[model samples]
Target: MVSSSSVKIVSKCFVKPKTIPEESKQPYYLSPWDYAMISVQYIQKGLLFQKPLGSIDNLLEKLRESLAITLVHFYPLAGRLSSPEPQKPNSYSVFVDCNNSPGACFIHATTDLCVADIVGAKYVPLVVHSFFDHHKAVNHDGHTTSLLSVQVTELVDGIFIGLSMNHVMGDGTSFWKFFTAWSEIFQAQDSNKTNDLCLKNPPVLNRYIPQGYGPLFSLPFSHQDEFIRPFESPILKERMFCFSSETIKLLKAKTNQICGTTSISSFQSLTAVIWRCVTRARRLPYEQETSCRLAADNRARMYPPLHPEYFGNSISALRTAAKAGELLENDLGWAALKLHQAVAEHTSEKVIQMIDQWLKSPFIYHIDRLFEPLSVMMGSSPRFDKYGCEFGMGKALTLRSGYAHKFDGKVSGYPGREGKGSVDLEVCLVPEYMEALESDQEFMSLVSL
Candidate 1:
C-alpha cells in the first residue's frame, strides 16, 4: 500500500495564457444551469501513464506551454469568479471576470509509489487523492481560487496528470474538450510544427441565457458564506469494477429478457445492476425510498441545439426513484426501464421547462442534496474519451478521480481501458456497504477480472 506520506510537493505556480484576448475584458456571465452547481465541489479527475523517458523538467515545461495556449480559447477558465452582485433585495448572482485573469494553477510533485501501487489495488489508495489539488474547495470558492488546477505527480515508474475544474465553468464535455485541445497543441509543437494551433472544434464560449429572463436572475442565497455546504469526511471505500463486453452483453440480454422489452440500453442495464446491488447492500427498510441521479447532457436537447463543443455547464440532473423493497423485489429489467424512461423523456421541451422553473425559483445543489438518503448519484459517463488524453508519451494508462465530490453513494462511470463496449465503475460507499457489495455474489459474478 502506498502511504500518503510518500507524496511530496515539488513546485507550484500559475500558468497564464500566452496572450490575453481583448474580448476577455468583458465578464463571462454564468448561465442558470451553472449556478445550480455553486455549492458542489470541483471536478477532480486524472490520467495515469507509463513513465516518459526524458527529463521531468522538460516534460513539465512542454505541458505548461501548451496549456497556456489552450487557455486562450477557453479564457474563462483562467478567470476568477466575480464577487456576488445583488440582483434585487436580499439576492445575488455571480459571473467570471476574464479581465486581469490570474490564470490556471499548475503543480509538479513526486511520489515514491509506482503505477501498480494504484492500478492493482483492491481499493483506491488514499495517496491517489494526494495527486490532485483543491481537495475541499467548492465551486463558490472560485472567486479567489484557481478555476482550474493541474498537478503532475511523478511516480516511480509512471506519471499522473490530475486536474480540478470548477463546476461553474463547465461539465465533463467541456472539460475533456479543453484537455483534447491542449493535447493537440502539444503534439503540434512536439512535431516541430508552426505555432498556429488548429483546434478541430474550438470551444463555444458564449453563455446561454434563457429568453425573457436575466439581467442576472437572483440566486437562492443572500450571501456568499451560505453557499458553502457542510461536508464531514466519511470513512469510505472506493473500488473500480470492470464489466467486459461479454458481461455487458449478458446483462443487456438478461435485463431485456426479464423486462420483456428490447429498448433498454447497455448503459441503463449496467447502472440498474449497481443501483439494485447497492440498495440490497444497504439493507434499508422495504418502504424506504431510493434514487439514482444521472447527469444528462442538454446541449443536443435544447432548442436550436447548442454547439456540441459548448464550453460551460450545459447539463441537467435527471433523477429516478423507487421504494427500496420494490427495487430489489423487481427483476433487473424493471429497474433498467425506469432509467431508460428518464433518459427517453428528457426531450427539448422538458429541458426548456425545467430551465424556466429554475429561473422562477433557483435551487442550488448542496451536500445534503448530493447525499440523499438511501440513494446513489451517478456522475461522468462511459462515453468520455479518457483514453485519448496523450501528451506525446502515449495514451493514458487509466482514468481516476480524486477526493472531491465523493460521498457515501457517489458513483463515477468510465469506459474501460479495453475497447469494445467494456465499462468501469468507480463506486464509493461507507465501509459496511462496500464490504457487503464486494461480498454480494449476485453482483460479483459478472465482474471482469
Candidate 2:
C-alpha cells in the first residue's frame, strides 16, 4: 500500500462535479463541446522555502484519498466511448517530478509537482500547444471542428500529468465545476480533514428522453459525406479578423436607420453585415440559402440548474438562415429583421421538440446523420473573462476559444466590455475567403476600426 507520509505537500485547488437527476438517464450522448473540457486539470508543485520539505508521494496519497469519490464517478465511463477500461483510476492518475532548471532560486520556482495527465499508455494523445500549432496551418472553411488536449506536465518538480477530453463532454462552466471540486478535495486533505471529502451519495444516472419522435428534423447526410471525404482544396477560404466596439456600434446605428426598425439586436445587425461583406467579396451565386448556426446555452431552459457541479455537456444549437442576395441587397434593418425571425424560429417549442425527437432515436444512426452538412457555426461565451482564473497570479494575459473546423467557417463572439459595449468577435474562415474580404476596402474599414 502507498504510504501517506511518502507524498509531498503542494498547492491546493477545488473542482466541482456535475449532478443530473435520476430520471433523465439514457438519452444523453456527450456533446462534442463537452468532451473538449475533459482534458483540463490543475498542476501542483512545491516552491523554495526556509522550512523543511515534505514527501511528494504523501501529498499524492492525500489527494487520492480526497478525490476517491470523484475518481470513481468518472472511472466507469473512461473507455466507454474511446477505449478499454484503464488498469487503475485512470481518471485520477497523478505524476511527480523534480526540476533544477536555470530559473531556480531567486525566482521561487517549484521542483516537486503533481500533474493531471489521464491518457493511458496505448493512446498517443496530442497536447494543447501542439493542437494550436496545427490550427495555424489550416483555414476554417466552416466545415471542420477542433479539440484541445491538455497534459499537465508537472504537479511538482519533474512530474507531469495529462488530461485528455473531447469538446462534446462539457463547456467551460461544467469543466470549472469539476476543477473546483478537485481543488476542494486537495485542500481538505492538506488540513487533515479527509473525511469531509467523502460524497454524500453516488451520482444518479439521469438520461434524457425525447417525447414522440418521427424523424423530427432534416438530418445532414450530405454534410457527413463531405466531412469524411478527403479535404479537397475548398472552393472558399476563411480568415481571422477583429472589429472595434465603436465601429460595430456605428454600423449598428446606421443599419437601424436604414431598415427603420427599432428592435434590431446587435447580433443580428453584425452578422448581417458579415454575411453581406463575405458574399460580396467572393462574388458567389446570390440565390442560395446561406445558413448560420448559433450555439445557445440551455442552462436557464433546463428544469433544474443542471447542477453547476455537473461536469458534462450541456448546450444546444439554434440555426438561422438568410437568402444570399436578399441579405446583400437589403438595408441593415431589413436584414436584421430577417435574421432575427430565423433565429427566433429556431428556439421555439417546435425546435426543442425536434431536438427531443432526434435524441430519442437509435443513437448510432441518428447522431451521425444529425450533425452532417452544417455550413457555419457561431457562438459567444464571455465566462472565460469573468471566471476567477486569477489564482493570485494577476489576470490571464490572453484567453482564446479552442479551434473548430467542422463547419464551412466558425464565428465566435465575445462581449467587448473591456472597451465600451462593443462586441469582440473572432471569425474563422478559409484563407481565400479571408483574403478576399481583407482586400475589399469597405470590409477592411468595418473590421479594422
Candidate 3:
C-alpha cells in the first residue's frame, strides 16, 4: 500500500508556448458559462500508462517540447486570470491576461509504487491524489496560479500523467479535445514526422456572449479568496463500480419494460439505478425529498447548436427530485423516467432561456449550495474518449480523478477500460453510506468489478 510519504517531487518548471500568437497579446474574454464556474475547483484528471523504453529525463523533455507546441493552439491556457477593471472596488470583470502571461506549470514526480498498487486496490489509494500538481485549488486561483498544470509521476513500472485545468476554461469535452490534440502532436514528433501538425478542427477561440449581454460582466466578489477557498472535504471513501455492456443492456431492457416505454437511454437507466440505490443505502425517511443532478452538455442543446469544438464550459446542471419514500418504492423505470423527463425538457430554447436568466442576475455556482445529505451530483460522461489518449507509450491503462470537487454522493462517469457500452462510476460517499452500498446485494450484483 502506498502511504502519504510514497511520492516525491523531482523537479518543476513552467512551459510556455513555442510560438505565442499576436492575438494572445490581448485579453481573452470570458462568457457567462465561464464565469459561472469561477468558484469551482480545477478539474484534476490523469491517465496511467506502461513504462515505455526511455530515460525519464528524455521522456520529460519530449513531453515539455510537445506541450509547448500544443500550447500555441491553446494559448489561453498559458495565460492567467486577471480583472480588466482593477480600479473597481465593488466589482471586477475577469478575463484571461494573455499578455506577459506565465506558462503552464509542469511537474515531475516519482513513486516506487507500481500499477498494481492503484488499479488493483480495494479502495483507490490516497496517494493517487499526489500525482496532480494543484492539490485543492479552485478555478478562481488562476489569477496567480497556472491556469493549467501537468504532473508526470514515474511509477515503479508505469507512468501517470496528470492534468489540472481551470474549470472556467472548459468542460470535459473541451479538456479531452486539448488532450487528444496534444497526444497527436506528441505522437507525430515521436515518429520523426514534421512538427507542423495541423489539428483536424482547431478550437474556435471566439468567446460567446448572449446577444443582449455585454462582453464584460462584473462579479460580486472583490477578492478572489472571498469567493473560493480550498474545499475541506468530509471523511469519505471512493470506489469505482464497473458495469459491463451486458449489464447495462439488461438494465436498459428492465427500465424500458417497467416504464412501458423504450425511450429511456442506457445512461439514464444507469443513473436511475445509482440514485435509487444510494438513497436506499442512506436509509432516508419516506417523506424526505432526494435529488439527483446530472451535468448536461449544452453544446448540442443550444439553439442552432454550438460547434462541436466550441471550447469552454458548455454544461448545465439538470436536477430531478422525488420523495425518498416514493423513489425507493418505485421501480427502476419509474426513477429513470423522472430523470429522462428533466433532460428531455431542456431543449435548445430552454438552454437560451437559461443563459438569459443567468445574464439577468449572474451568480457563481458553488457546489456547497447544491449538496444535500441524500442528493447525488453526477459529472463527466461515459461518452468521452477516455482511453484514446496515448502520450507516445500506448493508450491509457485507466483514468482517475484527483481530490478536487469530491464530496458525498458525487459520482463521476468514465468509459470503462473494456469500452463498448461499458461504464465506470467513481462513487464517493460517507464511510457509513459506502459501507452500506458495498454490502447491498442489489447494487453489488450489477457491479462487474
Top candidate (TM-score): 3
lDDT per residue as tens, model 2, 335-410: 5666667656644464456445544431211222333232445655434343232222222222233333323455
For all predicted structures, in order, the TM-scores are: 0.96, 0.54, 0.97
The segments of candidate 3 whose C-alpha lies over 4 angstroms from its true place after superposition are 86-89
Model 2 quality (TM-score): 0.54
Show the lowest summed lDDT stretch of 10 residues, model 1: 83-92
Q: Judging by TM-score, tell me the better candidate of 2 and 3.
A: 3
- C-alpha lDDT values of all predictions: 0.87, 0.41, 0.88
Error of 1 at 168 (Å): 0.4
Model 1: CA > 4 A from native: 84-88
Q: Look at candidate 3 and give me any clashing residue pairs.
A: none
Top candidate by lDDT = 3
How many pairs of residues collide in each model?
A: 0, 91, 0
TM-score of 3: 0.97
Model 1, 177-255: lDDT tens digits are: 8888888888887888638866888999988888777646667667877666846558799999999988998899888
Q: Report the lDDT tens digits of candidate 3 across residue range 188-263.
A: 8788874676787688778788887767887766776666646677878999999999999999999999888989
> Candidates sorted by lDDT, descending order?
3, 1, 2
- Model 2 stretches with alpha carbons more than 4 Å out: 1-149, 152-164, 171-240, 248-263, 302-311, 363-375, 383-388, 401-403, 415-422
